[model samples]
Target chain A: MIKQERAVRTREALIRAAAESFDQDGFTVASLTRISSRAGVSSGALHFHFASKAALADAVEEAAVVVLRALTHDAGRPGSSRLQHLVDATHRLAEALRDDVVLRAGFELSGEAARVPRTDLRVSWRDRVERQARRCEENGELREDVTVGRVVSAVVAATVGFEVLGVRNRAWLAPGTIAEFWRLLLPTLASDAVVARIRPEGTLRSAG
Target chain B: MIKQERAVRTREALIRAAAESFDQDGFTVASLTRISSRAGVSSGALHFHFASKAALADAVEEAAVVVLRALTHDAGRPGSSRLQHLVDATHRLAEALRDDVVLRAGFELSGEAARVPRTDLRVSWRDRVERQARRCEENGELREDVTVGRVVSAVVAATVGFEVLGVRNRAWLAPGTIAEFWRLLLPTLASDAVVARIRPEGTLRSAG
Candidate 1:
């Protein structure tokens, strides 16, 4: 293998192992030695890759953000209206959570992220939420009565709520359920007059 | 102090210490040794009162549940209608989250409760949501098209979502936000034809 390829492999292995250990055991129990041993590397290797446990955690969080952003990024492509964009984003997020442990690590770090401000991971999620709200405003997806701030707050709150539910009740967390949650919530947050167009092709019963 | 007074003090000490540790760290890290040391008691003394960490956590959870139950239990008392009862219950839950770390701990421990599934803390919250739904049905507070199951699920989901938000964003989780979240959600979840009756006398305004 090339020298750079070898370095990338070692870093990825360390991150994956650390993410798994951190997720299974809450941050307090996620010792570096356990993570290093799990990765089949010496403690020195882990240190060379990540100077501290917090740095390893930050890398895991950054990886998770990259995954989440990728899931939402495609939805904003041209020709998709704001409502379609949101539906697409929600659907993608649900699938991503189901298929990717790295993505789930974002939810795991969410609690810790709350304590530290201005991290790139935190900023990225906030930015995604804000962009969606701004798009809603520009497209008239939300009611005039609902300001961009209110819509953004409500959507952020709902997304966080959905993540918690997804964590606790993984069995019931399907894309359809998340889509239904957005369908119901979006209309309520939007003005009653403009709610019709964004109401989706069929009701939730049909969606189910 | 008298025996009863001494016992009360000890119990309070344990709960306070445990809450502090759990809040600073999390479930698995707040060892009995640390909790006892913080409380100025021997490990044997700690075990004398609570047999194990799980048992102790159970106690803390139960205390939190008691405070939560009190909010909804009295809703059925003489003069309160179902709608009024729900409004009160919603407000009380927000208050509980703000004033009571025990309640906060219960919420934080939700994922843990899911893993163990012994305490069934979720059942009471479910019951409260069901009660509100039943009341909505009786008072015709629901929209003609809404289902009790969906309304109940949304309410429960929002409660959890807002609580998670409270823990994760202490600064942004302002007073009355939880109540407002329920207020915004209930109407969307409820049938609109009679949704006004469920709205508290003067609480529904454009801002909400």
Candidate 2:
């Protein structure tokens, strides 16, 4: 049990160290030597945990996926409006991108120009969004002219854009930045009554 | 005159070859030798025009900027609505990204993690959008609830997001993609009269 616990702790430290390096310098410049040293492990030990840099990035992305799941957990709330589900998810995602290094690094790596992304965080996030937009279409939530595909395109692009800009400037990931997106987008999709009830700041029920 | 014309043509060929290489393999992986070969120029001739890879990339970006100027030149159209100016810019930008390799590669390099970007394509584009959004706020075209900063945030994020996503998928750069963005966002910021007049597909006068 102690050996397994130590193993887990070592893995956690390595992931954190890798996140910091990847976040600061990007994948091409990220140094595995620095990461292992920061994690208080030998190169051999680091390699034992992760076979290569890509493997390490995959682990960071995995840790970030866990964070993403928790960030968007409100989407599964038993009875919330599908529109609200999306609004809250964007807000929570912004919060995560702003506050969490692993998630931030995961996002950076996912969008990096160098690799075939192994983690698929952006694709999964986009898929979840498309699914919810479809639900909104089935109900009476969308505007008369709006289609699920259009909503998906706008929401995905804006959120992903925020994520991209946030790589250089954290302001892009601020709650207000996403709130502005919702404020403009919500009214275009929801009925006046529904729009009134949908909180652009995200409801207390889902604010991370 | 003949000698000077040959030099200009050789420089143009090198820049186009560099852009094609950078767009396909990214900045880090692009080979100078391959670029010169593709340009039908010897290594010495390529070096005479551009000092190094970074210099070549800068040339590509500058050429792309010239394309960008023509792409958004309609912003100067007299008596045009500022909202329409922004809309036309996005549509023309999408078309340019779809059709122009130098512009596309410039965008890729501007967002690239490998170096400090010299061109500032995204920054200049965002600045233009901010300028037009502020104009919208001042002209009573915006709804009472929307603010200039919010408009800038939503518009910049969505448009930049489209540019980034469009790098991989040309569909994101489709005219309809940007039109949908304006379609959803127009009603949120503008009154019914203004919204009805705003062309989501952009104006015929400015269509590229």
Query: Whose lDDT is greatest here?
Result: 2
lDDT of 2 by residue, B1-208 (tens): 9999999999999999999998888887788999999999999999999999999999998998898877766545556687887788888888888888999898888777767788878777788787778887776788887788888888888988898878767788888788888888888889998888889989855432
| lDDT (tens digit, per residue) of candidate 1 on B55-161 | 77787777767877776774355544565566556666766777778777776766542135354455567688787778767766666666676666666666665
The fnat scores of all predictions, in order, read 0.38, 0.64
Candidate 1 — which residues are off by over 4 angstroms?
A40-42, A74-79, A113-123, A191-196, A199-208, B31-34, B37-44, B77-81, B112-117, B120-123, B191-193, B200-208
RMSD score of candidate 2 (Å): 2.6
DockQ, per model, reads 0.42, 0.64
Model 2 agreement with the true structure over A1-208: per-residue lDDT tens digits: 9999999999999999999998887787788999999999999999999999999999999999999877766445555687888888898888888889999888877767677678877777888788888877776788788888889999999999899888778889877778778878888888898888788888855432
Interface RMSD of each: 3.5, 1.6
The Cα local distance difference test for each model comes to 0.66, 0.84
Mark the 10 consecutive residues where model 1 chain A has the least summed lDDT.
A113-122
Query: Candidate 2 — what's its lDDT?
Result: 0.84
Could you tell me the lDDT of residue B71 within candidate 1?
69
Q: What CA root-mean-square deviation does each model show from the true structure?
A: 3.9, 2.6
lDDT (tens digit, per residue) of candidate 1 on A100-124: 7766665666675223422444346
The DockQ score of candidate 2 comes to 0.64
